[model samples]
Structure formats: structure tokens, C-alpha cells
Target: MSTDKKRFSADGPAPRQRFWKEAGVQETADGFTITLDGKPVRLPGGNPLCVTARPLAEALAAEWAAAGLDDPKGRFTPADLPLTRIAGTKIERVRPEREHIIATLADYGAHDLLCYRAETEGPLTVRQAEEWQPWLDWLNERHGITLRVTHGMMPIKQPEPALQRLRTLLATRNDADLAALGVAVPALGSLVLGLALADGAITPAQAVAAASVDERVQMERWGEDAAILDRIAAMNEDVTDAARFMELGRG
Candidate 1:
């Protein structure tokens, strides 16, 4: 499979403003990544379900474009999209670009479409890891998708030294404290917050609780009171494992 991705950067010339159409389907390690606009967003690999869903997605995308739902950026929300009934499940997607469709697929338990083509790959960026974090959480917590984030099972089960370091950072109100631990407050908190947010919308309080030890840890640190940390850990097991998003499961 061969394909291409097209895009118009915000700083590009006027003639370069046009969106590139879908072109190739190249063979990827896990499966063939559908090429659109030259960029290859990962498509499901190896699973027959993912293999079969390709044509259907493409055909549906064209229909969406015809219906005026495909914006220049290749994103268009429609009142209703097509649905294909598979043997035991129904395949439905939010029509248009890669991200939304992949998200939709994950929401439905379509695991095949979510792999990153591990065999033929590129460096996974921090930003890409961030994007995939929520989905990982969803898969783990709700669907029981056990993935690795560090040396063992993901989403560190104990905060331990990391938690102690994080609390120290909060105590001093210093960025250096966070840097010393290898992550900033916001970034570290964001990962924990992402797990707490899995059930629904996230709140700053939840992020704060997960990021820090607990409200009472400052003035009163007790072994029994460690349950607060336990609660936070139960919600999100990882403390030192930033890269292991699979622990969070799918979302």
C-alpha cells in the first residue's frame, strides 16, 4: 500500500493552501497505513477487521467530502455517518480525518486499527505520546488493556521516591524541584490528571490530588493517611513511568 499526505502550513504560500487528497497505502510493520495528504497516521495492523475497514472508511470519506463535511483541513463533522455491520460488532466512525476516526474506532473496541506499526516505525515523540495517553488510559481502566509504560506493568503502582520528589517540588514552589525529578509539575500532573479524567471531565482538584501527595500531607504526614496516595495510585498507578501510556488503557 502506498499513499501521501497533503497539508498547507499556516506560513505556506497561497498556492500551497490547497489540501492534498488521499493517495497511497504503504505496507507498515503492523499493517498498511493509509496515506492521506502525505502524512501517515497509523491505521490498524494485522487484524482482519482493520484490513476490511479500510475501503469502507475511504469510500465514506469521499461521501463526506461530497456532502460538504470535509473541510480544507480534512475534517468535517456530519449529523450522521455511515455504519457497517460486522459479524459480531458494528463499525461506525466520525467521518473525515485520521485522528477522529481512530478515536471512534477505539471507542468501539476495534483494537486492530490502533497499533502504531511497531515493526516499521519512526521515533515516537513526546507530543505523540501525549496524544495517545488518554486512549491508553481508557483501554486499561475500562477495557482491561494491560500495556507497559516502564520496566513492568504501566502507570506506576506506587509513587514512592517520585511522589516524595513531587511533593518537594510543590513545597518549594520551584520549577527546579520538578526538573530535578526529570519532569515539570504541569507535565507530570497532566499525566495523572489524564487518568483521573478518564471517567469523565477532569477537574483541577483531581489533577492536584493526583499530582501531589494529598491535601493533609503537608502538615500531617501519617502512614494510615497514605490511603490518599493509594487512592490516587489506584486511579493512576504510574509515578516514574511517563512514557508508558498503555497502562492507562484505551479511552
Candidate 2:
């Protein structure tokens, strides 16, 4: 992975190869493209895979659906393909534009690490801090980096590693702790719960029962606010997702 340039180089005296030389990305008339982020490069004589934004992808799908552009082998073109979907939402297009979604939109860093707090899952799970121990140790060992930034500087609701740590924080807490994480505290329970449910999961109703807020509250807040839930959940992307984002998989 390109992000691993420094990572790999750190293992030995060998200087990290410049990421660009290794990237193998190329430029075309429209703009530069990476194999990972490239758009609509031609694949055969006169045939092209058009690339564009999600909005553009949807428009193409609508256009194709209307026209019924079936291929000679009965395949579909942009005009005929269904838009790729994520998070119960349909995307008109996929491919490189997802880069924008991940940065401006989805979870993890550009490299796709799960990006958790030093103590996400709130110090309870055996694996909370331990889960990220390798990453933290790696970053610390390599770069001396240790800032648990929860969200990106942008207003988009990115989950800082701090938030993952909060799960642990919450796990050990009583009502006072819940209150601390909510409205008056300005930590904003809506955002917190939304992230928790984003995986469309509950670790176990019984496990959360000791926390003592009615399950209805969780349902009410998120169920009533689907959009908020979507935004918040996306930011809390799992740790493994971080690797996928980088195309390096997990350690």
C-alpha cells in the first residue's frame, strides 16, 4: 500500500521508496488517475468505462434504464447497469469517486484503517485498546504519532479514534456517564448512538441492558432520523475497513 511506503521502509535502513514511483498512476486528457482511483479509461477498441461522480452515475443509470441499452451479449453499459449502493443507499456510480465519499463522506483515513481511539469499546472488551495496539504501536514506533483525532477537521461527522475509545468509556459507566455523553455534555448522544447502530447491530440487548436506558430510546432516535444515523454510522467504520480503504487489508 502506498501509505506503507514509510511503514515498509521503517523496517530496514533502506529509505522508503517515493510513493509516486510505486503508485503506477497515469494521467490522461481529463486529469490524473490511479488504478485505484482512475476514471473511465478505455478498455478496448472504441469502448470506454465512463467514470464520474455519484450524481453523474445515477443520471447515467436513469438514462440507460429508459433507453434499454442491452449489449450484444446482452450485457449492460453505464446506461444499463444498476447503480452501486452503499449503506442501504443506492449509488449511481462507483469506482474512483468513492475516494471523495471516503474522505468527504465515509470512515477511516484515505488508507482505510478502522481508525479507533486508543480505547474504543470503552475499556471493557478484552480487545478494545488491544485491538488497536498494533496500529498505535506501529505509528508510535515509526512516526511518533499519537493524536486521537475523532472527526476530521471538516463538519462531516467523522468518528475520531476518540469515539471508539468512548465505547469503552461507556461500557464502564453508569447513568452519570450516559448523561455526560449526551445533550448537556455536548458530546451529543445522538451522534454517539447513531455511530453505535450504524453497523445495524447491537452487540447484545442483554449486554446493553445493564446500561439501563430503554431500548426504545435507541430505536426512537435512530429510527426517526435515518439520515443522521447513516452519517454517524459511516464515520465509525470498523478497524478492518481501514485496511480495505488502503487496500492493504488488516495486520
Candidate 3:
């Protein structure tokens, strides 16, 4: 995940003056780029913020265009450009450290959330099987890799062959996909759920629910906490944004 906390801050540096009148997309020899009143957009790394996918370019343009639409002062912040941020990370970070990123993300499979089950049998355990097992089964059936499930906090060592298979699969993804996975995997804390989200195998809501089964069960037993609810809401937004980023990049 990105360590640049400021970029994802909810109250990013006070909204700056909006200088551009409109946003547009222009096709270039390399790919497509977003333009602010005809001026090409540049990433923080000082390179043109170009995307090989036109759909992603157009989406970035739309985000720029809508930045201050709802604010009376016509000002905006980094939070207003989620797609652009992810795209920037794709170019500025993931590309250069592709192999390292692949390995880091694949490591999630070793201690994936779905692989850990509730210690005592009850609603949480039942819900775990109901919500999480299908995806584990999907992983085995689709990729021939079965992740061993354990009950409680004790970590179970996943099969080395399975981990290697996952790493190989992750190596096949492009930088853009890896960028999306970076967000979704950390947010969901489960490589299985993140891959499922990226692959269109599950919707963002489904991923969130499956990942939050423990929290949901706790909330049911002890009532909801406002803070936890807010966290879950933020998580859903993150996952949804990542999913959209992946979809646009594929186009």
C-alpha cells in the first residue's frame, strides 16, 4: 500500500484554488492523457500522467472536471481525485518495483483472513464457512491451490506450492492491476477477497461482507459501535474505488 498518507487524507491540505476551467482527454502515440484546459496533466513524479487505457484516461478526466463542482469556492484536494491517485501510484511506484510488489502481495495468501476461522463454533464460524469457504473453493477449483483453514489465532502454514502458484498468478498482472490490488488487498486484508474483487468474481459489497464476517458477528452479539461502522464504511469506499480503477484500466 502507499505510505503517502497525505494523498489519501480525508481532509487533505486545504483545497487549493481551482485553476482549470475544464478537463479533457487526448490520445497520444504512447497512450491517452488527461488534459486540464488542453494542458496535459502530469503526475507528481513530473512525468505525463498517461494511461494505456482510454477508459481510464477518460475517467481521470471526469474526476478532474468534477473536483470542485459541489463546492461553492471551486476548490479541491487530493481526496477528490481517487482514480488519479491510484493511476499515479501505478506509474510512480508499482512499475519500478513490480517484482517486489508481486512478492509482497502474494505473501498475503500465506495468512489470508479467510484461512483463519473463529475458535469456537457459533454464528461467526457458520458465517465464515457460508461467506468465505466459497472463495477458498473457487481458488482451489480455478487455480488448483487449496489454502488450509485453521480455527483460532494460531497461524497455519499454507502449502509452499500454493503460495508459489499465487505468486506466479500475481506476476501476470500489469502495474495498473497491481496498483488496484494493492489498495483492495490491504483494505480487505485477504488476498482471496482482493483477487476476487479484481477478477469481477465478487462485488465490492460482497467482498466487504465476507471480509467483515467477524466484525459483523461481534456487532450482532454486542451491538454496533459507531467507530467500527465508520471504519467499515470507509473500507467499502476504498474497495469500491479500487474495483472501479481496475475496471477502467482493463478498458
Q: Write the per-residue lDDT of candidate 1 for residues 27-55, one digit (tens) a residue.
A: 54543343445555332332222222344
lDDT to native, each model:
0.32, 0.29, 0.89
Clash numbers, per candidate: 31, 21, 0
Q: Compare candidates 1 and 2 on TM-score and give the better one.
A: 2
> For residues 86-106, could you state the per-residue lDDT of candidate 2 as single tens digits?
211211222323333222222
The pairs that clash in candidate 3 are none
Query: How close is every model to the real structure, measured as TM-score?
Result: 0.21, 0.22, 0.92
Runs of candidate 1 with Cα error greater than 4 angstroms are 1-16, 23-27, 37-189, 198-251
- Compute the lDDT for candidate 1: 0.32
Q: For candidate 3, lDDT tens digit of each residue in 1-251?
A: 35334443555576666789999999999899899999999888898889999888989999999987767777678778889889998999999999989999998999999999989998889999999999999988877889999999998999899999999999988899999999899999999999888789999999999888888888999999988897898899889999999999988
Name the regions of candidate 3 deviating beyond 4 angstroms. Answer: 1-14
lDDT of 1 at 65: 34
Highest lDDT model number:
3
